[model samples]
Target: MYTPAAFRQDDLGELHRQILACRLATVVSQGPSGLQASHLPLLLEPGEGQFGTLYGHFARTNPQWRDLAEGAEALVIFQGPEAYISPSWYPAKAEHGKVVPTWNYIAVHAQGRAEVFEDGKRLLQLVSRLSDHHEAGRAQPWAVNEAPREYLDAMLRAIVGFALPIEHLQGKWKLGQNRSAADQAGVRAGLAASLDPRDRELAARISADHSAEAAP
Candidate 1:
């Protein structure tokens, strides 16, 4: 991803946080047919590496995984909060007209080779773990067994488990980083003033980042 120095996020911890918050990702790969992309709820296992491996399963009937080489290698894109930045948010726009509309967002790139595991036990374990991870704080936590056994087994059979052994990591945070502090504040203020809940959330995050950066 093309990122200016101000908008670039090299801090591993922050990048990993963004990746974890992103429940879904775009998994892209090159195939004989052409570039293929699949949307999947990816799990990021953080550890010592460029980035921890990503885990997700594909439907067995999905042809995208059919031609893929076994044993891990592909690009997974994890995207965090994103929003359109209106030029109206800029304080300097009225004076010199130096600004243009832009977007603010966070994204992480992970590349690795994937190992396809089809064992029934492994698949069951993977699903159970995933369920726990997502339902940890729920009032009434749901498990795979909440459904009938035959249905669950049939569902599992239709999918294939896989793990990407991560090789590279790239992250960018474009929360108006290229702008001056005053301009960034203006953007954040505008975002906060808006009725959109997502905008308010992003503004809070950008404000927190700014505060952290400005600390002595």
Candidate 2:
């Protein structure tokens, strides 16, 4: 991620919050065939290391898991709120017509050593945890043990679990951070009035950043 100082997001807690909110990550790895990427919902273990550890499972039929090695490098990308910024939202555009359209978004990149495992017990635990996390908000939450024992066992056997202990993490948040305060306010106002949910979310994030900057 190419992040300017003004747009860099280095707060570990904030990064974790975004990652959890995003839920899904793009896991990328390199192998003899070529670079492969898989989209998976991952759980982050904050206390696993200096950065953290990522846990997720892959379908047994997914060949992307075959690229994982004990100590091989892996990249996981977590994307948060993103929106298009129109030049009309910039105050400078009216001042001197120097503004151009751009994009505003947040993303976190986690690099780590990949480790793949296939223990049935571990797979069961992984599936249980993943289900718990995603189903918590449902009125009738589902559980791994909700199905028949033989069926659950067969389902678990069709997947493989993996862990990536994070070695490096980088975050980029381009929410009009490089623009003047007036311009940022203008962008926020424009985004707030838009009908797109993503634009409203980007506006809220920008407002939060402003509040954080204003804090003593």
Candidate 3:
């Protein structure tokens, strides 16, 4: 995460909020062979010293976790909306025509120890919490036990639950914070004109960052 001071987000609460918004993340680990990564829907435990405690599971047959992490440290990347910013959007292009394309996005990287194991009860708790958190709005909300008992049990056996207690966290909110106000305004307008929903969403975040900065 090569975040300049302007793009750096030091607020832990905001970082956690963004992480929760994007529940799924990529967990990377290193081992004797080399580096390995797995994409998993992780649950964060938020509190004091809780910024880094993440819980997730992978298929037991997925050797990536076992092969790469023997309780070694890992990095979990929680990504936010992202979009492309055309150089043409910058007002500077009209003056010096020296503007170049850039990307606007938000992401959080959490480094911590990887506890790779399957705890059945812990897995059940995690899945139940995930279900409640994500499916809270459904008319007929989904529950973990909607499946047959035997089937669910066997299915559970196929997966291994794990946690990564974050030792450190870094966040990058590259919403053109380094740009001049005029360029930022142009980017906002350009992104608002884009068709991609992601572009709009990322642009909104960038806008919010600017708004917060302007507040007394």
Candidate 4:
């Protein structure tokens, strides 16, 4: 990702937080046919490698896994809160009429060579962990063993698991950091008052980023 100095996010903890908050990710790899992309919910093991390791699966019928089996490097993209920024929200628009419309968003990219696996025992464990992670907030969390043994085994066999130890990690938080403080405050006020919940989320991120910058 091309990120300006003001928008660059290099903190490891912050990168992990953004990745975890955005559950679903786009995994892209080069295949025999061409570049292929798969949307999957990935689990992050933050302590696994220099950066971290990602765990996820693909349906056995999906050809993307076959591409990954070739040892080609993969890129995983995690997108967080994003919103459109109107030029009208900038105080500079009124002062000099120089501001133009843009977008504010947060995103993280992870790259590594993927390792595919088919071991039934490992598959079972991966499914169980994935289920538990997403179900933890439910009133009654579900487990993999709840289903019939044969059925669960069959379901597991239909999917292929992969591990990618992140070799490179990059985060971009474009929340109008290049704008003047007054203009940023104008954006915050405008977004915070909007009806869209996503706009409100972006406004909150702007506020948080401002606070972080102001901190000594």
Candidate 5:
């Protein structure tokens, strides 16, 4: 993450919030063969370690977990709201025609050595917690115990759980902070006018970041 000073996000709480908001993460690790990546929905334990701990599972057939079992450090990426910002949205484009197109997004990177396990009890608990967290907002939330005991046990055996206590966490919020206030406002206005929900989300993030910056 090559973050400029203006885009750097160092607040631990905010970083954890982003991770929670974007539960699915890209886990990258180096194995005996080479680099491998896995997309998994990770649960964050915010108070577990200096930064925090991440809990997730990989399919038993997935070789990436084998790498983690052998002590490979992992890099987990949590990507948040993002949108394409046209140069036309910047007021400076009209003033000096110097602006170029850019992307506005938020992301967090967590790095640490991962601890892998296949114990059925721990795996059951991990899956249950992960399920409950995601299902909390549903009208008819499901639970692991709802399924037949044998089926649930078989499902749990098909995956391997891992815990990574984050040693280093970095967040990057590239929401046009380098641009002039007028340009940022223009971007917000342009994005808010779009029908795409993602663009509107980015607009809201920009507004929030700007308000935080202007706050006393």
Candidate 6:
């Protein structure tokens, strides 16, 4: 999250958008045993707080939830597209041979107090919402109600629900903003020609950022 002013993303809506795009977040906490982290698909409840609130579940066997003290502070990191930029992609490399390889990526860090709970009603609501959100994109969407009630109930019994009221959020979009315009354009072109779809995505993000900046 070491972001220069040029690369800092302070827009709340944009931060939420990125978090939604990267649904799986890494939640980190500290306890007597030291730091522990869990990867979970968190759902953001926008407008639930000044920054927003995060909802997710943890497996009953996951020790991270048990070690996490009630109302303890946690950091949820959402990572977006990333790609490696070769020095050869920069025009400056040809001009002065001064450019070195770098990485271009976008990330959001959300800090908040986490509350773990085991209310079955709330857990059902959380599961239904999560299922709907993810299934909406599929041609043949699935639902929690599609399964047998007893089976779903048993499955739900094996998990714990948690909520995090976001106190602060930070975003960093490192898309070659430090480089010259020509160098950035070179990077975009190089990325566009690459075989990796992620590289092309980073290229599009870079171009989009530049476009927004250039807009009146």
**Against the hidden reference, what TM-scores do the models get?**
0.90, 0.94, 0.91, 0.96, 0.95, 0.93
User: Over all chains combined, what TM-score does candidate 1 have?
Assistant: 0.90
Q: In terms of TM-score, how similar is model 6 to the real structure? A: 0.93
lDDT tens digits, residues 1-216, model 3?
Answer: 798777888898898898889968998878776888888888888863656588888888877678535677788898999888999998888988977888888999999876777767777887788788889988989999887988878877888887777788999988877777888888888888888888888777765347423211
With candidate 2 superimposed using the best TM-score fit, by how many Å does residue 100's alpha carbon deviate from the native?
Answer: 0.3
> Which should have the higher lDDT, number 3 or number 4?
4
Looking at model 6, residue 40 earns an lDDT score of: 94
Name the regions of candidate 5 deviating beyond 4 angstroms.
208-216
At residue 211, candidate 2 shows an lDDT of 30
Evaluate model 6: give its lDDT: 0.87
Q: Give the lowest summed-lDDT range of ten residues in model 5.
A: 207-216
Per-residue alpha-carbon lDDT of model 5 for 70-175, expressed as tens digits?
A: 9999999999999999999988878889878888999999999999999999999999999999999899999988999999999998999999999999999998
Judge candidate 4 against the unseen true structure and give its global Cα lDDT, from 0 to 1.
Answer: 0.91
User: Could you give the C-alpha RMSD of every candidate to the true structure, in order shown?
Assistant: 3.1, 2.9, 3.0, 2.6, 2.7, 2.9
Residue 135 of model 1: what lDDT? 92
**Model 4 CA lDDT for position 22:** 90
Quantify all predictions' global Cα lDDT against the true fold.
0.79, 0.87, 0.81, 0.91, 0.91, 0.87
Worst 10 residues of 6 by lDDT: 207-216
| lDDT of the structure predicted as candidate 2 | 0.87
Task: Give a tens-digit lDDT track for model 1, residues 1-116.
Answer: 78766677888788778888887889888777677789998777788456677777898988667545543257889888777899887877886777788888888888877778
Per-residue lDDT for 51-96 in model 2, tens only?
Answer: 8999998999987788785345789999999999999987788888
Sort all candidates by lDDT, best to worst. Answer: 5, 4, 2, 6, 3, 1
Candidate 1 ranges beyond 4 A from true positions: 48-50, 70-72, 208-216
Candidate 2 Cα deviation (angstroms), residue 193:
0.5
TM-score of 4: 0.96
